[model samples]
Target: MQRRKVTLKLYPNAAQSARLEAWTRLHCELYNAALEERIDAWHKARKSISYYDQQNVLPQIKADRPELNELGSHALQQTLRRLDLAFQLFFRRVKAGQTPGFPRFKAAKRFAGFAYPDSAGWRLMQHGGSGATLRIGTGEAAMSIRARGRHRFGVEAKPNDITLTRRNGQWFVSVTLRVPESACARRRTGDQRRGVDFGINDWATFDDGRTIDNPRWLREELPRLAALQRQRARKKGSLRFKRLGRRIARLHERIGNLRRDFVHKETTRMVRQCAILATEQLAPKTMSRSARGTVDAPGRRVRQKAGLNREILSAGFGMVHPMLAYKAEEAGTRLHLSNTRQIKPSQRCSACWELVPKTLSQRMHVCPCGHTAPRDRNSALVVLIDAFNTQHTPGTGVAARPKPLPRQRGKSKSVTRETPTTAPLGA
Candidate 1:
């Protein structure tokens, strides 16, 4: 799906800027008022208030106060939509066992300007030099930079008040445009299927024994980040402190960009090479919660787990899987999400079917049956096997058995008991 986002450099004159701010404030007021009314009605009648009821009354209210009409009917409609979204979120949270509360008024620090339906076509007045004239209402405002490169044109501009705002000295503008989709013909040549295991020490391991190391960029940058934060905290509300805060925010943004770039590259490479790709469905949030601990009295195991989670999230494993799936479809490749819940891929030996008890610290899969391999690679092999079974003989009810491992080499021979069945791989 194609999506478009346009950022405009607005240069509204003083009078126009004030008008725009006033319009935004009025929009926020109408939104909060509608929300309060709905909440009060729900409290008194024990029933959900509908958006239709609010929309039906808005036009009459605007007619009584003609000044409200200047804020644009479409802008008021957008506010109602926002209120509806808020109410939906509240009910969803309540249904999920969370505390629900009334929607609050929009504060200045977080205020967003209004949106209006396109009716009158807006004009971008091209001018000489490095700037352009943006005509809004009866006035023309000159911007410092011209819209060039692949920047979107044909945006129906609204009143200056609907443009961006300067918050804490940073400027922003919002413009909407329709994006056209470009199709590419799919070409398929690969005949192999690949299974990937995502981990902490390594970003991904394939069944073919290839591995990608975890960059751990966040961990590496933590020391510098902590130092900057400490310095900023010491300055309190000073200008230097704000600058440092901005620097820290920029650093985070940079790291996020880099991580996203890496994930896209890796996912694209895999999708292009394999005819079928299989991977486990991991819950990053749950994994993160299980890894929290104090640094001074930190549990190595928990810290390691947390590190793995950070790596997984940074690599965008969850996002990459879906992206790869869609890209593969576009490329005539098949993407399969293996039923990790039924297979003990990590513990079950891929070759001899022995049960190998392994801790997170263990990097090697060494079975007493003389089968030795890298832990992730071995796990990937089992994942591939599971994928094959799922594709070929699904519901045949042939379960994997964890056989006893043979005696350790150069050690006394002892009887090994078969391990009990545990929860499946991805689960």
Candidate 2:
């Protein structure tokens, strides 16, 4: 079985929308109250409250607050579970010597969503390919929300979990479904492998020289976004400021949606065609680090570096490789992640296997062996080589193909190679 999440945009009448807002506000209040209780318990008695301690008090809570009876008991419990998970994460981070960002009370505006741990509280209907109908709670008082989305979950989609979220004044319900792998299978006889290099100028450059141009969505929208910010600053705390804030949120939402759509389409196509997908393991956080140094020392071209960082992030370098990985998994294809530190793809010449280091400004990779290509494309070629090398010799790249166990299937064949499967780095 495989898990897939489907998000549908919800359309509700004024009455239903108003009720949803009230319910959302209640959920936010509950979250804040629980947070305050935990803090006070620690400060007053030097005691920590567990999830079970709070959960045991839910019935009394619902009894005292009659309005909460409208929501299912399961959902209210899950909200407490969510808070427990946050504290768990905080502790884990502290143990690992990382900053422990203590869980804080959520403001109503920031608390955008809540989830149903199971399918008991909600039911979804997909009558056609274009849209869906979602009913939350039970009986006639239940809210029926008309939603728009083409449901995709192979042959059959079995909803296991659901969440209702509001983003940019739009309501959306996300359903997590369990699907059978056999039902979703699409057979392909492809035996080819391709390496991809992601960048700022071009979205992706395949080892074979094919390129996808970066749309630079954030860059294109920056002028209007900046103008809106300036106007909002001028009208701060006024009604106009709130309206402008909505506009800015909507614009950001649109850019993110379009980028995700583009990524899904492109990745689906690539996964379908290639048998093995090899990509560089890029650390986007490290690459896009701020150039503004501390007070002791300053950095040069701060604005230019910041712009470059934004461009890199806007290119979806972080999103693409992960999408490729999961899509490849679904397609039963191999995904190779070459280590950037060891492979040094950008510095190595793909043609001659020689180190030809170049700076960020050098867009063309020129090698003494007469190999010349776009910097990103050449790096992609090196990644391809490392992938093939790792296939024969593991540990050469980030995640090499796993060696099959002898007992699981049968005895391993004793076929031997006469020469080296692939040349060494310096050879």
TM-score of 1: 0.70
Candidate 2, 62: how far from true, in Å?
1.1
Q: In candidate 2, what are the lDDT values of residues 242-313, reduced to their tens digit?
A: 999999999998999888989888888887777766777888899999999988999889999998998888
- Candidate 2 Cα lDDT to native: 0.80
Return the TM-score for candidate 2, rounded to 2 decimals: 0.90
lDDT of each: 0.64, 0.80
What is the Cα-based lDDT of residue 83 in candidate 2? 90
Q: Give the CA lDDT, 0 to 100, for residue 415 in model 2.
A: 21
Best by lDDT: 2
Clashing pairs in 1: 20-161
